[model samples]
Each structure stands twice: as C-alpha cells, then as structure tokens.
Target: MLSKKTKYAFHALTYLGKHRDQKTVLIHDISEEYGISHKFLENILLELRKAGILGSKKGKGGGYYLIKEPKDVALSKVIRLLDGPIALLPCVSLNYYEPCAECKSEALCGLNKVMIQVRDEMLNVLENKSLADILDKE
Candidate 1:
C-alpha cells in the first residue's frame, strides 16, 4: 500500500518534471497549486535532493529540478526513495527482508511463495513506469 506521503511525493515530482527546464518554481507556488502543505512538501523535496533525484539552487533564483531526465527515472526508484520497499511482507522484500516472528520455515512457506510473486509483479509494473510516463498523463 502506498502511503499518503509517497503519493504526494509522486504527484509533486510529476508536476515538477512536466515543468522541468522552466523557471524555478517556489514551494509556496507548488503547494498552492497542488493543495499540499509547503513545509511537508519541502521535507519531501529534501529527501529527493538527498537521493540525488533533484537539484536545488539557493539564493536569488532557487527551486527544484530533476537531476536526471524523466525517462531516466524509473517509478520504482522514486517509490523506493519515498516509500521504502515495495513488498508488503518484509520476508519477501529484496532489500528490507526480515522474517516474521511467527514464521518458522521461510524455505517451504506457501505464504513466502505468494509474497515473492506479488513483489515481483509489483516491481515489474513500477519499474516499467517512468517519471516521463507519469508526467505524460497531462
């Protein structure tokens, strides 16, 4: 399940990607246009900046821009940056795997099998969808 924070992050990024190479857009402007809180959006942007997905120039003309083109950024990457692992079950997650306390045999567990398939399918879809695809909706 996607968190509200992750959803908001994607929406903001999509809006920014569509306006890439244009003049810097202020946080207040984006917040007002998107119905998001400026402070919350700024924190989201900070995470993106630390992930190297976005760049910011401070001082006279400062805002946000993609560090890479929309096509170069996979939706999975963005989601992971904001939402962490895509898998619902931590045991099935590739990066953040942790066996549940109740689960004893992960090796032959049917639940693990189902979760693995689910995680793979989720990854395939998200990996195929890029920032370009998201922004192109408009």
Candidate 2:
C-alpha cells in the first residue's frame, strides 16, 4: 500500500511537471487544486526539495518547482524516498534488507523465494516508469 505522503508527493510533482515552464507555483495553489492540506503538502515539498527533486524560491512570486526533468525522475525513487522500501517483507528488501527472525536461511525459505520474484516484477515496472512517462499518458 502506498502511504498518503507518497501519493501527495506524486500529485505535487505531477502538477509541477505539467507546469514546468512556470517560474514557480505557490503551495496554496497546488493544495487548492488537488484538495490536499496545505501544511501536509508543505512538508512533502520540503522533503522533495531536500532530496534535490524540487527547488523553491522565497518572497513574492516564489514557490516550488521541479529541478530535475520529469524523465529523469523515476517512480521508484519517489516511492522509496517517501515510503521507504518497496518490498512487502523486510527479508525481501534490497536496500533495507534484514534477515527474518524465524528464517534460518533465506535461500531455503519458501516465502523468501516467492517474495523475491514479486519484488523483482514490481521493480521492473517502477524503475522503468518515470514522471514523464506518466504525464505523457495523460
């Protein structure tokens, strides 16, 4: 399941990507347009800025903007940034791997084998899909 934060991050980024030519976009505008809470959206945008996915400006006519091209921003990166690991089980996680407490050997575990296949298939789609690909469909 995707977290609300991750969903909101995608919404915000998609909005910015669509309006990339604009100098900046006010948070309130995005919040209002998407019916997202201003405060929550603010935090999401701040995190993205810190991640170097977004850039912001202060003062009059200043707001958030996408720093990287939409094609350069992978869906997997955004999801992982906001929602942590993509794997359903900790043992299956590639970046945040942890041995299962009950499982003696990952190679011998039935669940681990199934989950690895699941994770790989999911990653194939996520890693290949970018913000630009998403927007192009729309």
Candidate 3:
C-alpha cells in the first residue's frame, strides 16, 4: 500500500505529464483536480522539486513543471523518493538493507529468500516503467 503522499505524488505527476505542454501548473489546480489537500500537495511537489524531478516558480502565471523528461523519470525512482524501500522487509531491501534482529542468518532464512524473489519481480516492473509509460495508458 502507498501512503496518500506517494499516491498524490503520482496523481500530480500523471496530471502534469498529461499536460506537459503547459508552461507550469498551479498547485491549487492540481489539488482541486484530485481533491488532495493544497498544503500536503505543496509539500510533495517541493520534495520532488528538490529531488530534481520537478521545477517550480512563483508569482504571476508561475507554478510547477517537470524538469526531467517523462521518459527519464522511472516509477521506481518516484516510489523510492516518496515511499522509501520497495521491499516488504528491511532484511530484503537492496538500498535500505538491515539484518533482522531475530534471524541468525539471512542466507538460511526462508522468508528472506522468498522476499528477495518478490522484491526482484517488483523492481523489474517498476524500474522499467516511467512516467511516459504511465501517460500512454491514459
């Protein structure tokens, strides 16, 4: 399950991707379109802008826009940015790996083994999919 922050980030990105032709999109417009809280959506966009995925401007006609091309923004990047690790367990996480306190050996842990496979499959899809791919589905 994704946090509302992550989910709303996706919604904003998808909406922006769909309207990439616009100079910039107002935060209120996106929040109104998706029923997301304006302040919450503003924070999410700020995070994305800091991560270099998005760019923003203020004052008249200024708003947010994609800094990177849609095809260059992978689903995995967005997920990791807003949702943290993709793995079910920290023990199975690639970027956020931490040994389980009770587990004697990860090499011998059956749960670890199964979760590795699950994580790999999930990554295979997410890493390959990009904002452009998502936009195409609409």
The sequence of per-residue lDDT tens digits that candidate 1 reaches over residues 106-132 is 997899999899999998888898888
What TM-score would candidate 1 get against the native? 0.94
Error of 2 at 45 (Å): 0.6
Q: Tens digits of per-residue lDDT for model 3 on 55-112?
A: 9999999999999999999999998999999999899998888999999998899999
**For model 3, what is the alpha-carbon lDDT of residue 87?**
98
> What's the TM-score of each model vs. the native?
0.94, 0.95, 0.96
Residue 52 of model 2 has an lDDT of 95
lDDT of each: 0.85, 0.94, 0.94
Poorly placed runs, candidate 2 (over 4 Å): none
How far off is residue 5 in model 2, in Å? 0.8
> Candidate 2: which pairs clash?
none
lDDT of 2 at 56: 99
- 10 residues in a row with least lDDT, candidate 1: 21-30
